[model samples]
Target: MNTPIDLRSDTVTLPTRAMREAMYHAELGDDVYGEDPTVNALEAQAAAMLGHEAALFVVSGTMGNLVAILTHCGRGDEAIMGDECHTFHYEVGGAAALGGVPIRTVPNGHDGLPALADIEAAIRPDDIHDPPTRLLCLENTHNRCGGTAIGPEPFRAACDLAHRHGVAVHLDGARIFNAAIARGCPVRELVAPADTVMFCLSKGLGAPVGSLLAGPADFITRARKNRKMVGGAMRQVGVLAAAGLVALDQMVDRLAEDHEHAQLLAHGLAAIPGVHIDPSRVHTNIVIFEVTDPLAFLQRLQAEGVLGVYFGGQMVRLVTHYGITRADIEATLVTVRQALRAA
Candidate 1:
């Protein structure tokens, strides 16, 4: 049988040959002592790319967001986010569990942005009864919202509103490069208004591991300590940083191909009678659709060597990534059509 066309998530991506070569030759030192040259270089590169004064490399996007929350908010302070955001649905509640910071959720529009008015209303007024709202968390290419890429103007307005309310913004930018590519904008432009932003190297970028949190120098200093508290500090980890550096250098522009493949997949899925999807809603690399029997459909697809995930209820999510070719997408569509006909 053929290798399964793994469309479950971009996190399943394998690093490229160039990334393997870089990892093998990476310069190493103890990152805990801040002496890892390759790691330092990756952080500096990420900071500059995101238009921030500094950056911290963390084990994952979840850890990076947790460290940012720990650094930005004191105990008992609240952080606000979209109800459908990855941090709220995923991430294991680290902010509240570890940092004592509670999260308040605002409804996310279909386009993956919390309404500015809703955000403003969620901010706590000065009162002894309310937990101070200190942070507003945003996601670009929001995972649970069918991977919708929030455009720059609306994103900037949301950040501006949070700032006006004395709320710092933390962006879950795990797939931000995809958003930038989809919107035809520079990555810095999308991230400029955020107080701090975390982007993953492992997901769409195809790095083997790691994410970077970029922001003001002082904030990063505090985040560094928070990282240590979360046991994210590493020693001789430049090998991983080297792959991340290669990912940043070579993996960004090619994301457009993944976006195209996703469009093809979405349109093809929409054509199938039993599959429900709006191809126009597919702005990035993720394709989410509804089926009458998600589990049965996934099982049938898996049997035919196509793999996707059953997202809650009747929703199914398939992510196009570095290894998925246009040909693979066509094969997936054929399989789906056949499955529906057989059913």
Candidate 2:
């Protein structure tokens, strides 16, 4: 049997040999006591990279977002977010369920930006009947929006609107590095406007686990309490943080390679009959394209040792990552072509 080309997501990426070795020798202590040097280093690095005063390591991206939400908003407060964003659509309503935070949804444009006017209109006035809007959420390299990179200008404008209205902004930047690479800027520039940001080391960075929630030191201090209340405090977490440090040091610059492979895959898929994609819209590693029947198309590809995931409707999502090479993209294209013929 041949190796399967798993294009389901960048989260499928395995830890590198360096990461494994780092984990093996990582100096460990109790993270719950804030004594884990490796975890502390990872948090400090992530905070500085995002231009924040502090950061907290969490179990997953979802947990990071939840902690940010709980820290920023009290019970019965509302959060504004893109309807199609990861927090609203994919986070299982953790904000509402766990934190008693209600969500206000604004339409996300095709480019992954919520219209400034829509965002402004969503903020609740001093009404006795309406829940106060406490937070504004944004996503970069938006998952449902063909991994589009929301540029700095639009991002700043949105955050500015939220800030003026007394609402803090929280960015669900699970793929912020990809957005930074696509826009040819530093990650700090992309994240500077956000009051809080949650980024995943387990995503495109290729770590096995852990995400960071970054903000002001005071905000993170509060979030740390919320994290413990939610049972996210862990001991000896330096083993995972060690890999995260390696990811930050070694994996960021190489994201451009994943972007290149995504473009190659998108262009090839666009040329294949029955595949529907605009290669120009593929800005980063995620390529979302349409097909006649996504499940059947994905099944055929899976049968041929090529794997991708069927998103809702006619959408199929393919993500390029560290382990997937240029050769793998070429092979995947060939396999997809054959699958189309078989259909």
Worst 10 residues of 1 by lDDT: 334-343
Across residues 1-343, which tens digit of lDDT does each residue of candidate 1 receive? 9999999999999999999999999999999999999999999999999999999999999999999999999999999999999998889999999999999999999999999999999999999999999999999989998889999999999999999888899999999999999999999999999999999999989999999999999999999999998899999999999999999999999999999999999999988999999999999999999988899999999999999999999999999999999899999999999888878
Weakest lDDT window of 10 consecutive positions for candidate 2: 291-300
For each of the candidates, the C-alpha root-mean-square deviation to the true structure, in angstroms, is 0.7, 0.7
lDDT of 1: 0.95
Spell out the clash pairs found in candidate 2: none
Mind sharing the TM-score for model 2?
0.99
What candidate 1 gets wrong by more than 4 Å, as runs, is none
Estimate every model's Cα lDDT from 0 to 1: 0.95, 0.95
Give the per-residue lDDT of model 2 (tens digit) for 1-343: 7989999999999999999999999999999999999999999999999999999999999999999999999999999999899999988999999999999999999999999999999999999999999999999989999999989999999999999999999999999999999999899998999999999999989999999999999999999999999999999999999999999999999999999999999999999999989999999999999989789889999988988998999999999999999999999999989888888
